[model samples]
Every structure is written in structure tokens, then in C-alpha cells.
Target: MVDIIGHLGMGLIWLAIVSWLAYDGKTALGFVALGAPFSLLPDIDLWLSKAFQTVNHHGVVHTIVFVAAASIVIGAILAKWVVPRFDGDYLVPPAGSSYVYAIGAVFVGGLSHLFADMLSAPDIAPQVEPFWPFVETKIVTVDVFYYNDPVVNWGLFLSGLALAGVIWWQADDDDSAVAA
Candidate 1:
């Protein structure tokens, strides 16, 4: 499963979660949606260094330490600062800061991304800094599955496309009836 495919599946799940939050909790849909994509951004580190590559992966970025630090730093910035600035004073009161939800949502997205990567990663994507400050044992494994499996990814992509088509078709029918 490529990172993109895993994130796509995760994105579908995230979309459902956000939509439910929007419909049921009266929460800001934008905040809930924020976390879904951020989850995939950490992999960008691969483009930075060949030293990061492993037998089955480009290391460093895929490790738990990396995931944790990234989720917190990025999540905080987006939740506490970027979102508020982006919205200006448009936030509904009492929610005070949409940052709360944004951070929480990003946490969920990051966690989901980690889990997805762990499941399909070719080997245990090496943990270069296993314990960061505590232990430095490099971990390895033989989990042959790619983080993004084309079969599953394409299946999901196609399914999502089909679902979108159905949704649009139904919406068009409704509009036609209304116009009539």
C-alpha cells in the first residue's frame, strides 16, 4: 500500500468521521477535515535524503518517533495558529478556537496514517531513533506488503469514484425534479 493509497482509504474514513461530526455535533466541518491530509505529509521526507532509505522503505520518516513528533508539531501549528488565522473571526463562539478540534482531528489522522503504514510497510520501516532519547536500537522486519498496495488502493480509488458518481447522479435527479 503506497502512502497515498493508505491515506486515501484513511481519507475516506476521515471524511465519514468529519461528516458525522458536522451533522451530529454541530462542530466545524473544516476543522475535522483538516487532519485527514496532514497525515500523509510526513512521507515528504523521502525526497530529502537517500540515507533515509531502507531495505523496504525510506527510513526515518516512517518510524514512530518521527510520526509522534510530526503529529504534535504540525498539529499544534495548524490547530493553534494557522486555522485561526485562516478563519479570521469567523469561528462560532464557545468553540472559542477551532484549534481544539483541528489538533484532535490531526492527531486522529496521524494515528491512522501510522497504523496504515505499519500494516503494509515492506518491513518494519526502520526506527533509526527507536527511543529517540532513551534507546537507539534500529528495528527491522520482513513484512513484504508495501505501505500502499496498488490492488487495494486502486480498488478503493475506484470505489470512491463510483460512490461519487452515484451521489452526483442522485443529486442531479433531485435537481431535475425540483426544476420540473
Candidate 2:
């Protein structure tokens, strides 16, 4: 239910923290290629349902099982294939730490999308069944703000930009230290 701006912002914020913690001094900007898109992935159902009618707005893709499965698959691909394939292709390839960063980045990005939709105020329905196929229990129905609200959407987006700036500044310092 969260707008694209808010969802993307949440992903960027998590990408910053995950990269910084997992790969010290890494620039969060580098993760946007992988993370930003995944952050909007859960909403794919919106488009699909419009076409085929099999999916729902807040449906199967919102579940913990779906998120966990995606994380595991993405992690495996990063750890086993993509990282290895890309190694030595770049200016020295990305650091080995990138493999680890990518796994966390994609997972966090995708999960953030679900989190936003869960907490967002629905247009009509009261709640979404995140555990749809398994439990049919609707949760996190707390309405923080209407999805179209400018403050929440723009605020999250701007906040992400500020945090990204901080990450870039820190990374420059780290690079300088390494050079020294």
C-alpha cells in the first residue's frame, strides 16, 4: 500500500545499514542496482492480478515464507554464481564482501516492501493476510498513514537521501584511511 517513493526509501535505508554493517566502509550507493528494484517486487502482484486475476493486492507474495524463500534463493545465487561470475571483471571486481552484501541487500529490500504494505492503511479492507496460504491471519493492520499522503512518502524518500549522503561521506573517509 505504501507508495513507490516510501518503499524505495525504506529499501535504501536498509541497504545502507546492511552494507555498512556487513562490509565495513562500503558505499551504500553501490547496492542500488540490486536493492532498489527488489524493494518494489512485492507489488508485482498488483500488475499480475490486473492481467491474469490470479494474484491479490496483499496476497501470497506478502508472506514470511515467500520472503524467506526469496532470501535463500537470492543468497545462494550471490554466494554461488553471480559473485563468482562477476569477480575479476571490474576494476578488480567488487570486493568479496559484495557477495555477502548483495544477499542481505536483496532480502532486506524485498522485505521492506512487504513491511510497508502491511502497515499501510488499506483503501477498503481492514487487514491483509500476510500469512495467506498457511494461516490466513491478518496482521499489522495499524494505519500509520494513507498511502498517498505526501508527508510520509516524501519524508521517507528525503530521509533516505540524507542517510545515503552520510554513507558516501563515511566511505570516502574509509577509502582515505586505506590509501594512507
Candidate 3:
């Protein structure tokens, strides 16, 4: 699958989770809209280069370790710098905490992105272990899914766009009512 397509798959899945956290329809949908992009960001490392270099060398960005580290850094910045500057309270843990539900949310979102790419990739010169360390081994061939299946890609793409449109329409209506 193309990187964007892979992200879209993960984004839709993440939306389901975010929706569950909301109190109302609009909030639930807004959470989903906000989360879709974050869920896909771990794969931004792919834009760095084709070659892998260290622990992070194995396309470090996609690895659980790398994502966790980056998330901690990001969470810290958001909690420390951004929040205080905006007169909000520190929200995320300043120092890393044991992997909690929130951390798991991030992990699932990021790991899904990696899985999307791995399952669809033809060349795994440095093969990936979907369950690393615990598995500590690489799989030899591609999995059951095709790399760029039209049906799967279109299904996910359409779903995301449709959901986004619904969310936007609701927002626009709310805005119009407020204006009136």
C-alpha cells in the first residue's frame, strides 16, 4: 500500500476509539477528525530516506521504541511549553510514565501505520517482525493481502472522506446557527 493509504486505514480505526471517548455526537466526531492525522504521523519518518541506519537505524521511526520516544518528547513539549504559554494546566506526564491507556492509544495508532506498510511491502530486505523482541524474528514472505488492492484502498478512502464531510457539515450548521 502507498504510505498515505496505509495511514488512512489506521486513521479510520483510530477514529472508532476516539469516538468512544466523546460525550456527544459532535465532540465524538471532532475527536476522530483530530486524531486521524496524529495516528498517521509516525510514518512521516518514511519521508526521511529509503535506507535504514542503529537501533533507530532499522527505520527507527516505525519501530515501537522510536514512536514511544517521539511521543514522550511531543507530549512533554505540549504539556510544558505549549500548555503553560496558553495558560492551560500541564496535562501529559512530564517524565515518562509506565505505558498507560493513553500511551497504548498512541501505540496502537502508530503500530497500525507500520503494519499497513509492512503487510503491503514487496521488498523487505531488512524484514520486519510485526511482534518484535517477543518474536525477535522476521517473516520471509508477504502476508495474505495484496500491496495495492483497489477495493481496500477505496473502501478506506471513501469512508474517511464521507466521515469528514459529515463532521464538516455539522460544524458549518452550528456556525450558521450561532451567526443567526
TM-score of each: 0.56, 0.80, 0.58
| Residue-level lDDT for 63 in candidate 1 | 56
| Candidate 1 wrong stretches, greater than 4 Å | 1-3, 18-28, 50-58, 85-97, 123-148, 157-180
Runs in model 3 with CA error above 4 Å?
A: 21-24, 50-58, 78-108, 123-126, 139-142, 162-180
lDDT tens per residue, model 3, 70-91:
6665545444444334222212
User: Which 10 successive residues of model 3 have the least lDDT summed?
Assistant: 86-95
Could you tell me the TM-score of candidate 3? Answer: 0.58
Q: Which wins on TM-score, candidate 2 or candidate 3?
A: 2
Off by over 4 Å in 2: 27-33, 74-100, 124-126, 132-134
Instruction: Highest TM-score: give the candidate number.
Output: 2
Best by lDDT: 2
For residues 16-36, what per-residue lDDT tens digits would candidate 1 score against the true structure?
A: 455454422223344434655
What would the per-residue lDDT of candidate 2 be over residues 1-180, giving only the tens digit for each residue?
A: 778999988777777767666544443445644576788877777788889877776777767677667777776676575545544322122465655656666788887777777768475534666666777766556677788777988887788777777876776777789789
How are the candidates ranked when ordered by TM-score, highest leading?
A: 2, 3, 1
